[model samples]
Each structure stands twice: as structure tokens, then as C-alpha cells.
Target: MTTTVVIVGAGPTGLTLACGLARQGVAVRVLERAAAHATGSRGKTLNPRSLEILADLGLADGLAAVGRTHLPFRKYFDSAFVNETEPFAGARPSATTPYPASRWLQQPQLEQLLRERLADLGVTVELGAELVDVRQDAHGAEAVLADGRRIPAAYVVACDGGRSTVRKLLGIPFVGDGDPEPMMVCGDVEVEGLEPDAWHQWFGPQGAFMLCPFEGSTRWQLQASPETDAEGRTVPPSLESFQRLAARHTGREDLRLSDATWLSTWRINVRMAERYREGRVLLAGDCAHVHPTAGGLGMNTGIQDAWNLAWKLGYVVRGLAAPALLDTYQEERLPIAAWTLDVTSSGMAAVVKGIETPGIGVEAGGVGDFTGLSLGYGWSSLAGGGATDALKPGDRAPDAPCPGPDGAPGRLFEQFAGDHFTLLAFGPGARPALAGLPDHVRPVALDDPDGEARRAYGITGEALVLVRPDNHLALVAPATAPEQVRSYLEYLERLGA
Candidate 1:
């Protein structure tokens, strides 16, 4: 079958890109090797930035209904109670930042939400379709299934994960170091004698063990330092081993753990692909980069990667921008991946140090900046045209309460809710630039009677702000140069020509 984009993998990254592309009316085919959707509570935290991306996709209400916004860290040292602290304590939603705290929602739950949304967009995930090889040329790419079927597309994205088959097929090197000792044994199991209100952690001299209760459920995610046998090989994780660890670490045999659902061992492996693109075949999510599960960044970073690439891919697939626009995907996300590796590695080191030292508490070491709001593309060539003291090109477009065209209550995010660029005209002086906009650009004239929008955007005078489809600032031109807006769009069209 021929399609515009063939995505390999039905995980969060691939599903997110599929939803974004399908929302923009791009034909997409999602292939997953597994026969059915996998069941695991992997990567439970959805940072604020990821929540904002989902909010733009119109899933904010759905997420809020199911996700827990506040789950304090309840720490314990060797079966004794310590203290509780919430990382995002006192964080409230503001006009500029809507989703302020990280959410506790399991990966499977999120994938289900995305799948439902994708189904609404007339796309479905094709299961049991394992990609054996990929062939790409100047015009298009083809995904070869193990069962002797070929799927052709204009481009292919490898969201297949850390041990990506597509990356290996393309001969891309995954450069990083794997820890000599395995890190932790993790799984989802039914638990009793634990309240589902906080993340329960137990740290001892032998190793640390944690059982974090899932929101609105009786199951808790289990993570414990690996136990090795006589040969010094790490013992594989199982229900029996999990029960033993719970008894040994928490010093309570009454804490019953039963019905082990999913099990796996994790190691500290920090690595990223040397590049994100190989001709028409691009990489995203865990396929492009894999880091330590510190700060709960693994899934959030992948979600952001798909969001950053989706708009560019939509523009290129729809013939609105050049392939050079696709180049910026690597130019922008690669650095963020690198920074993630560095910080997560440090976070992991801190945890390991805490584990080795007595009486030292390790409190989610990589929590800083995990919100991902401060990350941007200011260094990219796509960022240009003026800046304010409060905002600049490549910064995230802040949301504000503004009146719609009918002079009714509205928000900047409502204007940005679909697959379109948003051109914000700060005042009547900047309204002229909103005229003659491209079909994909949505124009919003701000009537800030109380100066709320101006206060949020730091716009003392009239200005025109061109927001990318991903809600990042593309151009911050003066109101006098209305032509700059049109010229910028034309420049984008002519890029890579």
C-alpha cells in the first residue's frame, strides 16, 4: 500500500506523530510488530510541556479526567518513615502556563487515548506487521515486512525504540555506554497495604526498592535494585522475586504483592543516534535517542520529539514547505536530546551515589527543568525577526485570555488548537499584518481591554507574533513591517529550492 508517511511502531512517539499528521489531513499508516497493544505502566509521568502538547490536540480535558496532578513523594529509609515532599508544590495554572504540574498517567493509558484520537481521524494501527528492512531513494521510501509485503511512502519514521530495527537497517550507530551492572527490576503488580495517594519509596543499605501506587487503581509499579545469583549474573525479575524484595526492603511481609502483569530489568544506558535523519527516513522518540529513566524524561522527551517533527512533516507532505524545513527537525531536536542525555546521566549518578551512601536520601534527582517549558530552538536558523525582553524567537508562545472575533471570552490556546499557524496581532496597529495570510495560518486580533494579553506577552506596543504550528515563536516582527510577515511565509515556501 502507498501512503504519504509510513511510521514503524505503535508506541507513544509513533502514535503521537500519527495523530498530528492525521489531524493535518496527511495520509498516515502506523505499523506495529506486536500482535496487540502491550500492557505496562512504563513512563508514568507526563510533564507539563507534554500535557500542553496533548492539550493542543484537544485531549486536555480527557487527560485531566484520568491523570493525577498531585502525588507527593513519600520517602522511607529502611522500613522507617522519613518525610513527604511534593516537587511541584504550590504550582498553579496561570494565563501564560496552563498545565503547570507533571501528571501521573501510565504509558498504556496515554497510548489508548492517542489511539482513540487517531481512530477518530480515520487512521488505525496495523498490528503484527514487523518491518524487516527499509529502502529509500530520492523520491520515496519502502518498508519491507517480514511476511513479504512492501509498503511504500513518501517518507518513513523509525519510532521503533532504543534498539530500533530501522536504525540498524540504516546502519546508524547508537553511541553510548551501558552500565556494567544492571540497574533495577521493574514491573506492575497488584498490591495491598498501601494507599494510592503518594509515591512510596524504601531505601536501605543493600539496595533501594520502591512501590508507587497508580492513580485510581489497585496496582503499583515496582522498582528494586537487581539481585544477582552465585555467578554474579543479575537474576531476572519475577513475581516471586518481587515479593521477596518487598518483604526484605520494606521489612514487612504483610505487604502482599500479587498478580504480576509485566516485568523487565532496566540498566543505565545513555545513548542517542548520531543523527535524526537519513534521507527520507527520519528517526524520532526512543528510536533517535535513549537515556536513563531519570526525572521521568524518557517518554516526555519522545512525545516532544514527535510534536516538534509533526508540523514540519505536515508542511512538507502537504507541499507547503521545502524538504529543507525537514532538516531543521534534526537541527532543533538533536541538541535537546544531547542535553537530555547529560542531565539524566547526572541524575542517575546522583541516585547511585545516594544508594551507596548511608543516610543519604535520593529525591528524584533529575526533577529540575523536567517540565520542558524552558527548552527551545533559539539557535536554529528558523528562529528570526526581533525579540522582546520577555519573549524571543524560538521561545514557546505564551497563552493568554483574549476576546475572539465575536468579542467573547477566549484564550490564545483556543486559537492554536488545530493544525495551523497562529498570527497574533497585539493591537489595531498590528492587525494589518493579519490580512492575506496563508491558508494554514490562523489570525487572532487581541482586544486586551485589561492589558492581560500584553502583560502575558510583554507587548507594550503593537506587534505581530507569528507562532509555528507547534506553538513556538517563528517571527516577532514590528507592526510597521507588515510585509515581513508575508515575506517570511514566502521565504519558507522557497527554502531548499
Candidate 2:
């Protein structure tokens, strides 16, 4: 079999990449080792930025319908709510963005929704097939399946995960060690005498315990340090141990454990590969980096990697962009992977080191930082200067609710839902400029998206934001001259075309 891009791993990252490419009318094939979709909610929270991307792919509603939604609060050791933040509160975007706040969702639901979208694009995900071997040359790449079938592709992405077969075959080192103090985590369980609606944790004398609701009925993921050495090394979880721990911490012994779905003993670690690409093969998702789930950032970051790379790869495969443009994947995303490793590792260390302060939230940034919406690529190709008064490139694109030209309130994200550039003309008479944009760019007058978009852009009357395909702001200015607009297009032409 032959394809444009052969993606390994049907996890969120690989699927999202295939979907993004397919949406752009690029041919892609996905290979996964698992026979079916992965069960058990591994990455349980979807950040606001991810929600925006999902919405653009028309998958957000499905995710929102089945995934979890939290009001965003943090409980301290003393049980006092230091600060309950509603970051998504009153989120009225201008024409530049779509979603306002984050959604706490289950990864499985997110994956299922993405799979559906990929199917709609006529892309098929080949599950139960593994990339047992791969060989690359100057012309293209060939991936060998375990069942003796051979597949050819113009390029390949190794989203196979942390212990990736592709990364290993390429002799790339993961280059980091697991956390010195490992936290034993388990999710397969039936709990008794516990609140199922709210996420809870207890910081006690022995150790700490974090219990959060999973998607299914009567299930919650539990994480803690083993009470006894016997349980610590090769722990077989039991109801008694759960009840005893709950009693010791929450002063309640009514908790019961049953029907363990899945449990794993693993430690948090800050690790990244030396490079994301080796010749014609590239690494993404956990294959590129792995961090502790302390911040719920692992899967989200990997999905983001796919989102960032897919469009560029699509352009390259379709002959719209130079193959060298694929190099930007590592240039832009490796820094983010490194930063996530550091941020998540630090957050995990806080839990491990027992940094429980009364009325104090988790570390410097708290849960909001881990949500991944605040990811900044100030050094990216799309970014402008380091900072701006309002919107800037590399920042999460701002969104607003506006009546479309059709007079129904539409989201700013609705404009760039597919493979198109967004020219956000915020000035008075900017519509003419938008109407005149080239075929490669999609123009939407913020004035048309909604009344709030003007305010968000700080445009009392005039300004504009150029949003990239990934929905990150590209450029913000008061008024763009025709020459300036042409110049920006020329930049895209040079970089991508």
C-alpha cells in the first residue's frame, strides 16, 4: 500500500495529525499497534486551546457532549478554597478566536470524536497494524508491517509513543530518567463511600492521595504512595488498603475498591528526544517527549504537536510548501516539548516533595498553566514581536461570538475551520481588503464576526489580526496597507510555498 503520510499510533496525536492532513485534502494512512481504540481515561483534561482546535475540526460538540466539564477550583491542605478560577468565564472573543474556556474531558472520547472526523475526511485508520520496521531513502520512505505487508509513503510520522519503535530504530535517545520518587497510579476500581462528582485529594501524614472521576459510571482514578513497603514494590490493590488510606486522610473508612480496570506503577519524568526528525522520518507525541501527568499535559502536548505539524506537512506533500519547511516542526515544537517536561516535572515534584501550604494553590502557576491554553511560541515563524498590547502571534488566538454575514451569531473560529488562512480585518473598511485577499487566505472582518471582536482587538474602530491555520494569531496591526498585506503573503509564500 502507498500513501502520502504514514502515521504510526492511533492515539490522539496520530489521529489528529491524520485528520488535519486529510482535511487539507492530503492523503494519509494511520497504523496502530492496538486492535481497537484504547480504553481507560489516561489524559482526562482538555485545555481551552485544544478545545478551539477541536471545534475547528467540528469535533468539539461531540467532545463536549460526552467529555467532562469542571468549574475549575483548587482545594488546599486545610480544605480552604484559596481561589476558584473561571478562566473561561465571560469569554466573548473577537473575530480572531472561537472558544473561551477549557473543557475537562476524557481522552478516549476526544479520540473517538477525532476518529469520526478523520473518517468523514475519507481517511482510514488501520488499527491492529504496527510499524515493525521502516527504511527511508532520498525519494521517500517505506514502512513494514508486522504481518508482512509493505507500505510506502512520501513521509512518515512516528507517533507510536514514548517507547517508539521508529525512534528506537533511528537510534535516537529519549535522553532522560524517570522521577527519582515514583508515584504509583491506578484507575481500574470501584469506589465506595466517596463523592463521585468532584475531584478530591487528601494530604496526610503517610502520603497524599488524588482521586478524580473517570468518564464511566462508578469509576475514579486513584493515585498515592503505598502505605507499606510490601504494597509499594509489587502492590496488589485491595479494598482494605483503599478504605484505610481514605480513613487516615479524609477521616472516612467507607471507601471500597473493586473491579480494577487498569493500574500501572510509573514515575513522572522530564524527558525529550535529542531531535524530532532524522532524515525523512520524524517523531511526534510521546515519541518526542514524556512528562508526568501531574499537570495533565502529556497527551495534550502530543496532540498539539500533531496539530502544528499536519498543516505544514500537508502543504509540503501537496507541493504548496518546500520540504525544508517540515524542519520548522522541530524548530517550533521542540521548545514546547522541553518546556512541558520542565513544567510538568516541577508540578509533579511539588506533589512528591509534599509542598502543601494552607490556602495556597499548587505551585506558582496552578492548574491553569497546565491546561495548555497558555502555550506561547514567541519564537515561531508565525509570531510577530515578543509582545503586543493585545493579540500577538504565538499566543492562543482570541475568539468572539459574532453574527456572521448571514446574521446568525457565529464563532470567530468558524471562519478558519479548514485549511485556510484567516485575515482578521478589524478596521473600518477593512472588509474591502479582506474581500481582495488571495485564494490561499480566508478573510473575515471582525466587525462581521461579532461586536465584541472589535473590543477584544482593542480596536475602537480599526485593527486587524492574521490568524494561521493552527488558529494561532499571526499578525496584529491597526491598519494594513495593501503593500503590507502583500508583503505578509510573500512571507508565507517564501516560508511555505
Candidate 3:
């Protein structure tokens, strides 16, 4: 069957892209290798910007209901609490964004929630259907499944993991090494003697060890970097090894290992694909870049990629833009990925050097502590290159409370809950300009129309803001100027929409 977009690997990034596309009424197919939805908890936290994305998709309430609101900061040295940043002061949401702070949650829960959203959007996922083969042409790409079913799509997006089958099939060199000097181990096990409410790390003689309590009691994630022996090989991991290390590090001799969920080794590799697109097949997520897990940036960066690409694909499929618009995806996101890799690589180096510095320097309640919302792309076509611009193309578009035209208090994002472009008009005078927009565009006026959005656009008084389907600010105008709007629409036309 032919579809608008065929997404391989129904992980968080692929699933998020599917949902975003489906919400835009674009036909999409998600092929997952797993027999069913994921059950294992992998990722640890969801950044505030991701939460805002979830909120726009209308899944925020469910996630917020189940996820734990992190409230405290606890750092340990030899299993003893040293100094902690005031948890309440760590991160805060912007007055413009609905979600100001980050939340802690399991990856399984997030994937399950995203899958439910896919169902809500009427997009079905083909489980246990792995993409064994792929062939791309000038027009489209055809992906062959393990079961011998061939699916054709206008475009193929590779959201598979680091070892992506599509990526390998395309003969794209991964172009990176494992850690030059590996020094980290990660395993899920049921262990005693740890607090579940906080992330606990213990710096010891040979290397540091960390115990992060899982959702259930007696279950925890034990990660440690053991000293290499004379031959330069660390000891193989086992329950006895973990128990002995725990006792030795924490002075908690009574600790015992009960169940081993997963035992795995980890390394830091900061690498980017030489190119994000190969003909009609494109790559996102870990398939595009792999970085150290210093700030939990891997999955989050991929999700943002999904978000950035989804709407552009939809626009192209709907005959609203030219295909060249797809090129912007790589141009805009690759730099962000490169920057993230560098920052995380530095952070990992600090950790390996046994330097006890903060991952996020701000207090627990401050906005500066999180990595999600603060990332910006200055060189992209999506952002307005205005001085002191509040809403740039590569920056997040903050939401605020506004009254609908019906004179009731409503949220600016609530209007975006559906599949369509939103034309946000600030001040009373911009309403006529919004009304004159094409039928494909949805219009919204601020109840207490202030120039904050105008200020974001480097304008004053009445201004018009064009928001793409994926919530990106396409263009901003000082007033009801149709020329600027038409210019952007023409640009979108050149992109294939």
C-alpha cells in the first residue's frame, strides 16, 4: 500500500512523528519490530519542551497524571548526602509556555501513551513488521517488510535505533567509535538500600556508582564504572559483583540483589550522519546522531526532529509546498544535534575526570537547569532573523492564556489542538488580516491582545504571526500586511505544500 509517509521503527521518535503527521490528516504507516507496545522503561525524564509538545497533542494530562513530579535534589558522596541545589528552585516554566518544568517518567509509559494517541488519531501501527529492505527512487521509496509485504510511500523516515536496518541498508557509514575509553555500566536490578524519591550517585575510589530507584520498591537501576584490572578489562557484571560494589561503596552491607531486569554496558559516542537524507529515505533520532547520555538529550532531540519534519511532510503531501522544503529539516536540525553532542561530550568528560559539577547549573526550580526548552537554532530559515526576536524559527513558540473570539478565557495552544495552520493576530486591528487569510489557515486573536507576540516578531502594536502545523512560527508581521504573509505562503508553495 502507498502512503504519504512510511515511518520505520515505532520507538518514541517514530511514533511521535507518526502522531504528528496523522493529526495533520496525512496518511502514515508505522512499522514496529516488537510484537506489541513497549513495556520496558528506558528513558528517565521528559523535558518541559517535550511536555509542551505533548500538551499540543492533547496527551499532556495523561502523562502529567502518571509521571512523578521531581521535587528534590540529592547528590551523594560515598552514599552520603553532600550539598544539594534547592529542588524547588531548580527549574521553572516560562510565563509563555504551558509547561515550565520537566517531569520524570518511564519510557514504556511514554511510548504507551504516544501509541494511544496514535490510535486516537486513527493511525494504526503494524507490529512485528520489521523493515528488512528498502529501495528509493526519484519519486518515492518502497520498503519491504520481513513478512514480504511491500509498502510504498512518498517518503520514508528512518527513526530506528542507533543500529538502524534502513541506515545500514542504505550503506550509510555510522562513522563513529564506541567510547575511546569505556567506563560506564548500566543495569536494571532489584536491590536494597536506596531512596526512590531522588537520583542518587556515589563517587568512590576506583570509579563512581549510582543507584536510581525504579517505580516499584526493591527495583532499581545500578550503574557503575569499575576500575580496569592490570590487563585493562573491568570485571564482568553479576549479582554478586553489584552486591559487593553496593556494600563497598555505600557501607550498606545488608544490600542484596533480587531480580535482574537488564544488564548492559554503555559508552559515549558523539557522531552525526554525513547526510540526513539519502534520496527519498530520510533519517531521524538515533539513526541520525548518537551522543553521550549526559542530559538525556538523545530521545528528546529525536522527538524534536520528528516534530520538525512531520508538518513539512504533511504540507508536501497535501500539495501545499515543494519538496525542496524537506532539505530544511537537515539544515535546521543537524547543527542542534552537533551542539548537543559537544555539550554532552564535555559533560561526560567531566564525569569521567571525576569532576563533581552540576549537570544543570541552576537551582532545582529554575528554568536553566533543563535541556529541553532552551535549545535554539539561529541559522534556520524557519526562524525570523530579527534582533532580540522572541519567536525565532528554531526557537520554541511559547503559549499563553488568551480569550477566544467568544470572549472566554482560553489557551493559545488549545486552538492548535486540531490539524491546521494557526494565524495568531495580536491587537484588535490584526483580526481583519486574519479573516482575509486562506481557508486552510485558522485564525486566533488574543483576548487581552498585548504586543508580547509582536515583540517576539520584532514588531509593535498590531502584528500577525503565521504558525505552521507543527507549531513553528513561519512568519511574523508588524500589522495586517498581506505582502509578508503572501511571501511566506509563496515560500511554502516553493517547499511543495
Instruction: Report RMSD (Å) for each prediction in the order shown.
Output: 1.4, 3.6, 3.2
Q: How displaced is residue 437 in candidate 1, in Å? A: 1.2
C-alpha positional error of residue 488 in candidate 1 after TM-score superposition, expressed in Å? 1.3
Alpha-carbon lDDT, every model: 0.88, 0.72, 0.73
Model 2 regions lying over 4 Å from their true place: 71-101, 230-251, 355-368, 384-388, 448-451, 460-464, 477-480
- Model 2, residue 174: what's the lDDT? 91
lDDT of 3 at 215: 51
Scored by lDDT, the top model is: 1
The TM-score measured for candidate 3 stands at 0.90
Rank by TM-score, highest first.
Answer: 1, 3, 2
Model 2, residue 238: what's the lDDT? 58
Candidate 2: Cα lDDT at 200: 66
Best by TM-score: 1
User: Residue by residue across 1-497, what tens digits does model 1's lDDT show?
Assistant: 24999999999899999999999899999999999998899889999999999988878878977869888888788788877888788999998898899899888889999999999999999999999999989999999999999988999999999999999999999988788778899999998887878888788787888888877777889999987779988889999888888888888978888999789998888889999999999999999898888788899999999999999999998989888999999999999999999998888788877764544444547645889999989998889788876888899888899886688898888888887889889889888888888799998889989888888778899999888899999988888887878888887888878
Candidates in descending lDDT order: 1, 3, 2
Model 1 misplaced stretches (Cα beyond 4 Å): 356-362
List candidate 3 stretches off by more than 4 Å: 86-94, 215-218, 227-232, 355-370, 384-393, 449-459
